[model samples]
Target: MKNTLKISLKAGEKIYVNGAVIRVDRKISLEFLNDVQFLLQQHVLQPEDARTPLRQLYFIVQVMLMGQAGEGMEKTRQLFRDTLANLLSTFRNERIRAELKHIDTLVGQGKVYEALKAIRALYPIEEQIFNKDSLQEEQVFAKAVGE
Candidate 1:
């Protein structure tokens, strides 16, 4: 084992571990003796919330970790790769691009939780980009109307 991971959970909190969904009835702590793939309820992103490009990518990777990979792991991984490639080509933000690459490395190493964290961290930046684009479009429309 590389290192043990300790997790605390409140009553009714759900955790997805190695494709198993576990819900604790009372406050509890779990110490994993070995590395495991697990996701807490709070980190799980709803399908509707995956509205942006990076979020959509996160959702795809989440599927792989959550064991909801409909067809198979291989197929889902392929989808992840394809979606990531598209995002890499679509965004010009240097920071976002660099972080995306780091996320990819995490995913490649089977560090899905770390990758999710990285993706969540980029949400604010993504929002800023979208907001800026919307503002620019509104400005262009205002200028045209004034002409």
Candidate 2:
């Protein structure tokens, strides 16, 4: 029998594997964690590309999930922690948070279609802001108050 593991990505990407359906909505934020898991698996199976930021974060999340780490693993875990901290510290986007929360609720209530619609609405904005450093911080409060 093939062992199936359901993993979710909270960054708005849901994928089903084997007989398991993994919901990637924001309430759980599983995508970021899964990304870390992928990185760790890559490191153990293929160490050559472990230097990348994404891979590094994966390694750290893996170590933390494993409970204990040894020599080399400890260093890698620390690096991952530092990188994640830095990323989270500078990553302040209220709209994304609100959207993610809404998605999570929709997914939990089995409203997949509505969740998809919500995600679609934010896709363009997400892509634009994802890597850009100079984009104006959107005024989420204004929109919230208006609503």
Candidate 3:
């Protein structure tokens, strides 16, 4: 509110600001002298990437931000919490659990950008978890065949 923020965008790059999508024709820099809600291009997640539990959570949060909290926002929020709850049960690592909790709090406060950042930070950890689960499943199958 009191401080200003500056953003630079490259040609063909897009930014979603307060529910509006803006694309730069060329390299441009914008300065916001007041509070604003915006997301950069790299941070945006494609719908197809929502296959994972945490990614699904991120998609729901993105919809809430872009939809301007219109009708169904609450339902979307419910989905977010539900997704988080499911992930919490599946991921027992304290670090992952703590990140999920922090994301929930950020989203509750309408800080979608921060929530997305938090989720992105956990992506590598999630990948590791998924790989481990796959390896375990393969081992189980191998044991069954050997028996």
Top of the candidates by lDDT? 1
Clashing pairs in 2: 9-31, 10-31, 36-58
Cα deviation at 73, candidate 2, in Å, is 32
Q: Using alpha carbons, what is the TM-score of model 1? A: 0.93
Model 3, span 29-76: residue lDDT tens: 999997778888888889987888878888888887776565588888
Q: Is candidate 1 or candidate 3 better by lDDT?
A: 1
Q: TM-score of every model?
A: 0.93, 0.30, 0.90
List model 1 lDDT by residue over 9-29, tens digit each. Answer: 999999999889999999999
Question: In model 2, where do residues sit more than 4 Å from their true spots?
Answer: 1-91, 134-147
lDDT of 2 by residue, 93-138 (tens): 7775576567556644645435545645655565566546433334
- Would you list the clashing residue pairs of candidate 1? none
Where does model 1 exceed 4 Å of error?
Answer: 68-71
Candidate scoring better on TM-score of 2 and 3 = 3
| TM-score leader | 1
Model 1, residue 2: distance off in Å is 3.8
